[model samples]
Target: MKSPKQQSGDAAERRAETLLTGRGLTTVDRNYRCKGGEIDLIMRDGDSLVFVEVRLRRHKDFGGSLSSIDQRKQRRLIIAAQHYLQRQRWQGPCRFDVVGFDGSHEANWIKDAFSA
Candidate 1:
């Protein structure tokens, strides 16, 4: 049994996935988590590996979903990404992306949103 909020989050992630796929990115993993942190989606863009964070906000106040990803969260995401790459044999270039969704509009993708 999932709570309404969790269900909503799942739906939002699904929507983000669809939008990314439409842009030609291939999904490699979902909800990848470890002791360090969690990554919402792991995708591939051309030859680069991408780590994405999906945010959903009900209103435009306080910067909406885009602004919700503050410094601390970015740190966690970076650490998680490093762990993921270490586990895999991949030594190629990678970047962090953000997908913001405001309830009234379509999802927005912010590529290379941050770095290590």
Candidate 2:
């Protein structure tokens, strides 16, 4: 059985996919993983390659969902993205995006959330 966290992640990915698609982004990959780390979603937004991190939180007691993706997480994502590109031999324009979700309060799409 999948852990609760895993299940939550899956749901978040699904929501993120729908949201991105609604905004005209085409999903290329979901849960792209490597030795470095994992990328929640990889998509194409117009001519740019988009690497998205999907975050979900039940409430904003400590901090909002987006705030959870801090510097350390960003570094890991960057490393993972590099690994993905190296393996795919991808040489194109890319940007990192964060899709933050907290129940029923509009999902926030933070584009170029971090640098590679």
Candidate 3:
């Protein structure tokens, strides 16, 4: 059985996928885990690969959820992304995206949130 946090994270990733699809992005892989970290969603926007990080916060009392992805988190995601590309032999353009879900059932998608 998954813990509550795990379930919530899954739900959030699903929501992010739906949101991205609505915006013309197609999902390729999801919940990609590695030694460095996990990428919530890996999608394709046209010919470009997109690595999405889904952030959900019940409230904004302690900064926004997207703000929680600090430098260390970014580095971990980068490492995981590089590992994924190397394993898949992917040589296409890629970008990082952040989908921040505020409690009100809306997620703000930040494209090109970071670069390698």
Candidate 4:
């Protein structure tokens, strides 16, 4: 059986995916991973590729989910993204996005949340 924490994270990722697809984005991939890092979700937003990080924080003791993504994490995401793009031979446009959860039904989406 999945642990409560794992289940919560899965549910949160699903919520983020639903919110995005409802807004006209098409899901390209989920849980894209490389040796460098992991991308929670990857979606097509118009002509661009959006690499997403889904962060769910049920408590506030360590601050919010948004603040959890620091420089090191950003670099890993970037490296994974680069690997994905290269393997797919994609040369259009790409951006980083963040889906933050605070024990809520709705997630907060930040488009172009970070740069590589």
Candidate 5:
């Protein structure tokens, strides 16, 4: 059984997926895991592949949800994305995005949040 924290995270991912799909992005994969790291959501926006990281914070303390993804986290995400691309043989355009949820606040979607 999933712990409450894990369940909450799943719900957050679902919310992020819904928000992205509402904006015309289609889901490619979810919770993709490899040895290096895991990707929360893989989506397609137009001809570009999108690697999204979803973060949920109950409070805006210590920089909040968006600030949680620091350089180390970004590196892990990049590593995971590369692994995915190699497995899928994807050579087309791709970008990283971040979806942050702070308590009951609206979602904050940051496109091209980082480069590989």
Candidate 6:
């Protein structure tokens, strides 16, 4: 059985996926993992490949959901994205995006959140 936290995270990722798809992005992959890192979602926006990170924070005590993606996390995402690109032989344009849910509010989608 999945833990409550894992279930909640899954729900968050699903919500993010739905929102992205509604906005015209097609899902390429989800929860893609490599040796040292994982990507929450891989999507295609027009001719560009998009790597997405989904974050959910029920409480806003310390920081917002988007703020949780710190430097270390960014590094991991970048490394994982690089691995994915090499494996898929993707030489086209790619970008990083972030989908964050803070509390019970609407989703926040930030395009080109960072670079690889």
Residue 71 of candidate 1: its Cα lDDT?
Answer: 96
Q: Model 4: per-residue lDDT, tens digit, 1-116? A: 99999899988989999999999999999999999999999999999999999999986558788889999999999999999999999999999999999866367899999998
Question: How many angstroms is residue 45 displaced in model 5 relative to the true structure, after the best TM-score fit?
Answer: 0.3
Reference-based lDDT, each prediction:
0.94, 0.91, 0.92, 0.92, 0.97, 0.94
Could you tell me the lDDT of residue 98 within candidate 3? 99
In candidate 5, the residue pairs with backbone N, CA or C atoms under 3 Å apart (3 or more residues apart, or in different chains) clash, namely: none
**Model 6: per-residue lDDT, tens digit, 7-107?**
98999999999999999999999999998699999999999999999999998768889989999999999899989998999989999999999888999
Point out the worst 10-residue segment of candidate 2 by lDDT: 99-108
Where is the poorest 10-residue window by lDDT in model 4?
100-109
Q: Candidate 4 — which pairs collide?
A: none
**Regions of candidate 6 where Cα sits further than 4 Å from its true position:** none
How high is the lDDT of residue 57 in model 2? 90
Better of 1 and 2 by TM-score: 1
Look at candidate 4 and tell me the lDDT of residue 81: 98
| Cα-lDDT of candidate 5 | 0.97
Please, what are the lDDT tens digits per residue for candidate 3 over residues 1-116?
99998898789888889889998999999989999988989999999999999998888878888898899999999999999999999998999999998787688889999898
Mind giving the per-residue lDDT tens digits that candidate 2 earns over 1-116? Answer: 99998898798889989999999999999899887789999999988889999999988867889999988899889998998888888888999999998866778999998887
Off by over 4 Å in 2: none
Question: 1-116, model 5: which lDDT tens digit per residue?
Answer: 99999998999999999999999999999999999999999999999999999999999999999999999999999999999999999989999999999998999999999887
Where does model 4 exceed 4 Å of error?
none
**Local accuracy of candidate 1 as per-residue lDDT tens digits, 20-84:** 99999999999999888999999999999999999999998998999999999999999899899
Which portions of model 3 miss their true places by more than 4 Å? none
Candidate of highest TM-score: 5
lDDT of 2: 0.91
TM-score per candidate = 0.97, 0.94, 0.95, 0.94, 0.99, 0.97
Give the candidate order by descending TM-score.
5, 6, 1, 3, 4, 2
> What is candidate 5's CA lDDT for residue 51?
99
- After superposition, candidate 1 runs with Cα above 4 Å error: none
